[model samples]
Target: MNYEAVIFDLDGTLIDSMWVWEQIDIEFLQKKGYVIDEAAINQIEGAGFTETAEFFKKHFNLAMSVEEIKETWREMAIKMYVERVDLKNGAKEFLEFLKAHNVKMAIATSNGREIVEAILEKHDIAKFFETVVTSCDVEKGKPHPFVYLKTAEILEVAPSRCLVFEDVPNGIIAGKNAGMTVFGIEDAQREDAKRRAKDLCDRWVMDYNEVIDILKE
Candidate 1:
């Protein structure tokens, strides 16, 4: 388990911001005279920011362009990310440990760059990461391996030497697809979803503290 670089998924994995998106989805659809449902949410589960917007426009039959949809979500999300979001328990400590070890780090997130930057700065943890790559920076999002591959490339690390921390099945698959070891970070997902994630990842943990303990051994 000697990984030279670590890549993380931002939302549910690194921070407790997944709830923000769930709320945004409900409000956004309500504003558009549509209702949010399980099916609608499932359709964009592993999508990148742009891909999610595209899905929203098409599936919701909204008149807003993809960019407009993205803008609306960004506008609704930025304040929450900057003010309300916090890192998951033990995340900062694990980050500090990694930094002390001189391990390279990066983010491969489906979230927009604006909110990601805002939250990173808000937490004052931006210095811990060497790079941040959003799904918009690549051709596809999670489950496709594009963003993960792009991040490893930016870190100048081979895929085999990289470790990815993810919360969902798609993100775990993306890391594995990139030929990196994947660790599943538990989030607020349903039991079934958590089981699926565990099945896909090389390891699983409820928080970064568990990882720190393991590494210390």
Candidate 2:
């Protein structure tokens, strides 16, 4: 592999939380006397809090600040992280391999820092990532390269020499825009996830085990 550092996406890529948003988003909409279409929620999957919250506020015509909307998600996510989140298959093993190879690793997430830190600490995976950046820390979320570029820059690695592991099209685009390699993770439950991911990603994998295979090459 021609890479010195790896950047990762947190949500669907590192943990399983696709349907978790449905409960919060739907309940919030219902509380606002609005009905949320399943399709709309599906489309919002993998989006950052700001992006998703903005969509909800605008599309649903909800009277709430983006921060407030994001807070709801954060609150729910922290609970889920403590009570629900589990590492994606082979995630730990892959991390161990990266550590063994002395590969530099960082996380660039669409999720807020609070939520990200909770999961990392809960799973005891904080040590695996040398640095962490959230959308809240940057001007824009995925599909904008600021966070990804920042990760590469902070790690002192050239864009072309970094590989980004993402499960969504937005993050994939961001990685590619930064001239870095993008590897899309596939979740079998979300069939369309792969198709959407391939639209922008350079490579695809079913799981972190597949990543191990790629690194071996």
For candidate 2, list the clashing residue pairs, or say none. Answer: none
Please give, for residues 1-217, the per-residue lDDT of candidate 1 as tens digits. 3889989899999999878999999988888898887887777887899999988888889998999988888999998888888899999999999999999999999999998988888999999999999999999998899999999999999999998999988899999999999999989987887899999999999899999998888
Model 2 agreement with the true structure over 1-217: per-residue lDDT tens digits: 5788988888778887655666676777778888778678565654666877888888888788988888877887789778977889999999998889888999998778898888988899999998998776777776888888888878888999898898767678888998999998875445565688877788888899988998898
lDDT score of residue 40 within candidate 2: 81
lDDT of each candidate versus the true structure: 0.91, 0.82
Q: Which pairs of residues collide in model 1?
A: none
Q: Give TM per candidate.
A: 0.97, 0.89
In order, how many clashes per candidate? 0, 0
The Cα error of candidate 2 at residue 9, in Å, is 0.3
> What does the lDDT come to for candidate 2?
0.82
lDDT score for residue 172 of model 1: 92
